[model samples]
Target: MALALSLKVAGLAAAATTILGVAVGFLLARASFPGRNVLDTLLTLPMVLPPTVLGYYLLVLLGRRSALGTWLLEEFGINLIFTWQGAVIAASVVAFPLVFKPARAAFESVDGQLEQAARVLGTSNTAVFFRVTLPLAWRGILAGVLLSFARALGEFGATLMVAGSIPGKTQTLSIAVYEAVQAGQDDVANTLVYIISAVCVAVLLTAGHLAPGRIARR
Candidate 1:
């Protein structure tokens, strides 16, 4: 159950971060506006801030008693706290910078002349991005995405604060390991640790292979 939930939440978080990260990354790389650096730093905060601090921020912003939380409940009957969706959100925020920074670098590294040529050839802006820019930047973007997935898979602190482990529900692999150790289930804790470590190692290796320099060398 813990493994399955961890995969599910990580997958969702990866998907969410990929979309937002790619969009924001493209914006940052292609557009220069006031406060762009500030915006970038703010978006990247979750990566540097303590996990518990991020969790507390999430609680204040999304908890039942908060205005947005109350409005969401009143309008859509949705409550984020203590839910797997909440876990997804927490993981997504934490893993966002992993995706965002690399994506920005990747997009910036793309040859702008190629995109300009495509535009000059009557291709639409969207087409140029999809065909020229995205293809060129795919390697770095993918590396970041893989890293983000791994990060999400091992997420614990914020998920704990917002989702509250409830075994078979919000209890992911990392949380399960914590619970097992706390309960003196040495065997279970060791097994979970090994699993997470192995998975993370594999992901890191894969992401390394997808790095732009490595791919270029190939």
Candidate 2:
């Protein structure tokens, strides 16, 4: 159950990260605008910020006292705090940078000449991007997706803060390991650790396989 829940949240987070990350990455790579650097820095901040700090920010943004949070609760009857969906949001925010950085690099590496040629042939920007740029950069984007999923799977501090580690509801594998150890369940902790470690290794290996240079090197 714990593994299934962990995969569920991480999977959802990864999917969301892929969509937003790819869009932001393409924008960063292809567009120039005032404050672009500032936006880049802000997007990358979660990668460097402590997990607790990120969690605190999310808490403030989504807490009941905040207008958005209150509106969400009152209008939509939807609450994120202490829910699995909250964990998904926290995981997605933290894992976004993992996908964004590599995806940006990949988008930047694609030859603009191709995009231009397509534009000259009367293709719209959206069609050109979807047909040309995305296909060429898909491998790296996929790698980033795998990395983001792994990061989300291992998220601890932020998830704990937002989701509160409820058993069978929000107790992810990482949280399960921590709680197991805290209760002196060494065997259980070890088992969970091994499971998570194996999963992470598998994800990273898949990502490495999809990385830009792997096929060229082979």
Candidate 3:
């Protein structure tokens, strides 16, 4: 039961990560400032890096020793490292690239000329984005969001390294389920396995429902 709760927390982390990823994707797709490639590469770095490496870097940044960590503890009394929240942050950051790439692809697929036409008709760029581009790109964004959520739900190395499988405290389904399997407690792990399997099916189903053909009105 506690393990299942941890999984729930992890699920929240995935949702938060998808939200952040969508924002980043929007910026990357729409903005054309200098150093754009650098920003794009940075956004994508987490996807390529080993999960362990990304976890390690995050640990250094948010560990009890870091100023931000210390401030979080001092000001908000919030401790991230070794907590469920840390697990969420780790999972989200690692899964971010998955979300951003698809969302970016979706946004880029929109014809700039259509937006320009909207602008010529007295629509502001923001209005053009909201009215013209968003409706067309929503499917891609939804697809990316589903993919990111799935990746976050399955995050193992980063969640383990940062959260340390502390049973009810920090042990998410991915980690506790592993421990159960390793301890020959296959039955215990089975529950989590089924849950993850169900979640995967649900996300894919959602993506299908949100496919461009469905989201777009003829």
Candidate 4:
């Protein structure tokens, strides 16, 4: 049950982060607003920062002390610290860069002419995008999203720091494995390690197959 809950939280976190990654990737690739470079750096920050540091920042952002965090509690009654949902947020932030990089690359590969042709054929820009562009670049976006999902699944430091090692709740497979190793339970940790490895291999292989040119050309 504990393992199942961790998987569930990981899945939820991965999905949330992947959604954020898609929008960020699209904006970074197609738009050049002010402070674009800064935004890009911030988005990529988690990749470099220690997971504990990322968790700390998230705690500040979502804790009762922060103004933004307080407003969330006052207006929406949503407390984000030290909760299962907070685990999701922490995992998502850490995995965000994985999703963004691939999706942006995929979006960049799409030929502008195809979208233009759709527009010329009386399709609106939004329609052309969903009908044409997305179909062409779906593989890359999917690869990115899958990578993010896998990263979220294995997130340990941030998840543990922000969410704590609460069994049947915030504890994820990575956290469980960490605890097992710390307590000298090598066998349990080894089994969890094997599972993580299997999951990573399957996701990465699928991502490889979904990469550009893997699918038959239209």
Query: Local distance difference test, per candidate?
Result: 0.96, 0.96, 0.82, 0.84
**What would the TM-score be for candidate 1 when compared with the true structure?**
0.98
Off by over 4 Å in 3: 2-7, 208-218
Write model 2 residue lDDT over 1-218, tens digit each, in one string.
Answer: 88999999999999999999999999999999999999999999989999899999999999999898999999999899999999999999999999999999999999999999999999999999899999999999999999999999999999999988899999999999999999999999999999999999999999999999996698
Which portions of model 4 miss their true places by more than 4 Å? 213-218
Candidate number with greatest TM-score: 1
> Quick one: ranking by TM-score, best first?
1, 2, 4, 3
Taking all chains together, the TM-score of candidate 4 against the true structure is 0.92
Which digits, one per residue and each the tens of the lDDT, describe model 3 over residues 120-155?
999997788789988888778878777777777788
Candidate 1 wrongly placed segments (more than 4 Å): none
- Lowest summed lDDT over 10 consecutive residues: which window, candidate 3? 1-10
Residue 34, model 3, lDDT: 97
Error of 2 at 17 (Å): 0.3
lDDT of 4 by residue, 90-181 (tens): 98899889888877887788898888888988999789768987888788888877788788888888888788998777778888898899
Give per-residue CA lDDT, model 1, range 1-218, as digits (tens): 99999999999999999999999999999999999999999999999999889999999999888999999999999999999999999999999999999999999999999999999999999999999999999999999999999999999999999999999989999999999999999999999999999999999999999999988888
Q: Whose lDDT is greatest here?
A: 1
Candidate 2: regions farther than 4 A off = none
Give the 10-residue window scoring lowest on summed lDDT in candidate 4: 1-10
| Rank list by lDDT | 1, 2, 4, 3
Better of 2 and 3 by lDDT: 2
lDDT of 1: 0.96
